[model samples]
Target: MTSTTDIKAIIRRHRTRDAAFAVLGMVCLLVCIATLMALLVDLAIDGVGRLSPGFLTSFPSRFPGKAGILSAWVGTILVMLVTALAAVPLGVAAGIYLEEYARKNWLTTIIEINIANLAGVPSIVYGLMALGLFVYQFHLGQSILTAGLTLALLILPIVIIATRESIRAIPGSIREAAYALGATKWQAIKHHVLPYSTGGILTGVIIGLSRAIGESAPLITIGALTFIAFLPPAPVQRTFPFVNFDWLASPFTVMPIQLFNWVSRPQQAFHLNAAAAGLVLMAMTLAMNGIAIYVRYHSRKRIKW
Candidate 1:
């Protein structure tokens, strides 16, 4: 029923809306890219001077000539490894149980809701909890062990959620087939289900660990000392009285904490050091994420079945 002029008007208006939407999207995308580029440029310009062999190897120092992040780097790696160890098994297991074992009951629903809520809770809150339990009540103090455990707790929900999602994405027919083959629940999971979900689980773990490694609020709250020049020594017995868990009582520092300290200082050199440390941390995180992506790509491409 429309005339030629009416049809033209409708078409013109539609084109205008499309154009506006496209422009808006492009503007948003460009803004994000520009922000990333600006930050990288700033970091490189400021931090390149501080990236030296000495910077990588020497322990932390109050004096610029002697300053380095060796201990902080070492402790950070150790804590991250320990955290991964604690988080992966439990997170993956919890995920697998939720996806494969748990029934759709009110109890499971409540647990799931709690986990989601926990993931959203502030990281510092977990640190405070660790402070109360491990530092005050049990007297574990603000040591590497307590810090690692606190981070573990902080990231556990994330890991569990990621793992559950990954496992759930697997087709149910696979499980049904395994069951039809007279496989028990554990056998089906161990032999068939797990192999299928390994890559997904690894990806989730890497992501969780990435988040944990950069976290400073919780670690700081747990009293990770800013200046601990000496490497954490291996536990030794002092047979004067009751046994003490020395690992849980020692002071520690980490990359993010050191970066925070350096950035807050008045000196420009400290600011430079903070940027260099930021670059290193970013590189480490990107490497972990890359590895996860590679695993996912290869695993998906090389399916045996």
Candidate 2:
């Protein structure tokens, strides 16, 4: 009877501890959400008045009232385009080679460890590296291409890690089934592995791009101008072939640099401009994440297992 009473006491204690932990987790989550909400509210309050069509279309000016993100946003888009073009394919290919084709060995193990470590390296390190390798050694100039490639290098590890993790999540049975059907390794991977992993891969890509979009350190190190009044040459042309690549070699500045420039000014109006730019940057990030969510949902729905 005494032993039974002791067991009951232990059960009650365990339940109480579990309840306490649950409450603690809830409080932490609420704290995070509340903090984020407060920041969004503050940004909105300070910047909403600046969000007009004219603000979107005008160029940066010495006067606060005339300054806009036209060049900044355009440069950002062009830089991101180059970044995506350079990083996505190479990162995905490297990931597939490592995860699917590489033999299990010490070298592979070392490579994996280094890749993971690279993902955690500081953004400034990449900036410094690019400054030497791209600007000095390769003579890529302080152009859009240099900035894009620099950001691509920054995010390559992230894409590779994400791709490997996504590919690893697929069940072995799927690959086995494909092999059992007399499919070659490449065919099986192309048909079974890739389709299932597309959502996760895209999520990683978007996440990398999101990070790339906000990065100013690498671009600045590579000589991104803080003040620019002109846009890059148009990527589209009226002539034959109808597409142009001259913009890739043009000078540029991104939104983060523009915001940094504004925030550094002594005028109160520029501070408001900075806040508005921050809101736009946040919106762009959220939009990219939203697309990732939508794609992931559909991809998961389409694939049962």
The prediction achieving the highest lDDT against the true structure is 2
Q: What ranges in model 1 sit over 4 Å off?
A: 1-10, 234-248
After superposition on all C-alphas, the RMSD of every candidate to the true structure, in Å, is: 3.6, 3.0
lDDT of 2 by residue, 1-305 (tens): 56988999999999999999999999999999999999999889988889888888999999898889999999999999999999999999999999899999999999999998988899988999999999999998899999999999999998999899999999989999999999999999999999899999999999899989999988888888998999998999999989999998899999999999999999999998999999999999899888888877887788777
Write out the backbone clash pairs for model 2.
none
Q: Worst 10-residue stretch by lDDT in candidate 1?
A: 240-249
What is the lDDT of every predicted structure here? Answer: 0.85, 0.92
Query: Candidate 2, 301: how far from true, in Å?
Result: 1.5
TM-score of model 2 (CA atoms) = 0.90
Output the worst ten-in-a-row residue range by lDDT, candidate 2. 296-305
